[model samples]
Target: MADNTAINIENIYKKYNALLEGHFLLSSGNHTKFYLQSAKVLEYPQIAQKLALSLAALIKEHSIEVECVCSPALGGILAGYELARALGVRFIFTERVNSEMMLRRGFQVTKGEKVLICEDIITTGGSALESAQCVAQQEAKIVAFAGLANRGFCKAILPNNQKGNEGSKIQAQSPICKLPLSLPLFALANFSFDIYPADSCPLCKDSIAYKPGSRN
Candidate 1:
């Protein structure tokens, strides 16, 4: 079972609210009542240290025997580094190269190595899945996954029972049978379609001021 110490959903939310800003379209494409500006926390070494400690404690408690830690580039980079430090292991990240996410810059995962995938947040699990795929290509075993906030969607569960490939493709072989967070899954599609291109967005149609969402 996963440890509960690192999965502080409530504190994560409070910290998020403190850092969030104006109307934003999340990567999930949902109009969020809240946005998790992870960079705010990442930028503060003290806060980032605190979070890293929590994640390290959880790894110890769970006895997760991972050889390496991996995360998607950008948002997951900081957290992944912290977790790796806590675990005393090597850390690597996958990045989008020419529109596809892959492990570049000579990053290698030896076959049969145990890997723990981490993320800052999981809205649709797209980026994380891509990183997982890269790991799979190296024939590594993804022992488990960690995230600061799960936001209720199960990347393990597809909308139509479709199997999502963990590494090669964004499909899963089975519903995530195990996830640390316990929240109801609300389809991103169920929320109002508030996202729009610069010119065609409904917010623009109504003259609502737009705030730039984070690209990192």
Candidate 2:
């Protein structure tokens, strides 16, 4: 299989009905004209493997030691597991217990164990950070973070220090990720779409708001 780059991912999304158009209520409480439904794409095993292989390649290029791959519950499960498979590392996930992410299901990380945090889509990187925090709580080291699609918040800095979306006019770090700039964020592609707060969204005025996302 060919290396799944941004264009390849975008095309796969379109083919899988994962990329959608219209007003959507994002998990971040913002509104966007487009949405990336990662589950839809991951539903196909072959496609999921391709994406994971690409991500693993990136991680290997950096020579990042990965003892385990950790992901947030619900959304990141599939991608995280697949990436773990590609990397031949253990897979664990954090789930919302009492509205807070917890490392449950008998999962445990030892002190100084290298871990990679992953997700399907990184908008504000809230979930990924939460998962990373869980890993930290276990005294584990977060080697890096990876995602399939960057929702403009996290920049895709490959091991070679190249921007994943280099030469693309649409490149900007969103106020979301909040992680230290020194931390690396690797993703296959960057899709920068317009998002607005509910109070000021133009779509809200027209009553065009419709929550088409997985989030309630």
Which predicted model would earn the best TM-score? 2
Clashes of 2: 0
Clashing residue pairs found in predicted model 2: none
- The estimated TM-scores of all candidates read 0.67, 0.89
lDDT per residue (tens digit) for residues 1-216 in model 2:
335444366788999898998888887788898999998999989889988998888878767899999999889999999999999999999998787999997999999999999999888888888899998998999988889888776666532233443522335565666554556777877777888987789877666677765445
Candidate lDDT (C-alpha), each = 0.59, 0.81
Model 1 misplaced stretches (Cα beyond 4 Å): 1-21, 155-216
Residue-level lDDT tens digits of model 1 in 91-197: 99998878788998999999999988877766566677778889999899887776655444454321222223232123232242233233221111111112333
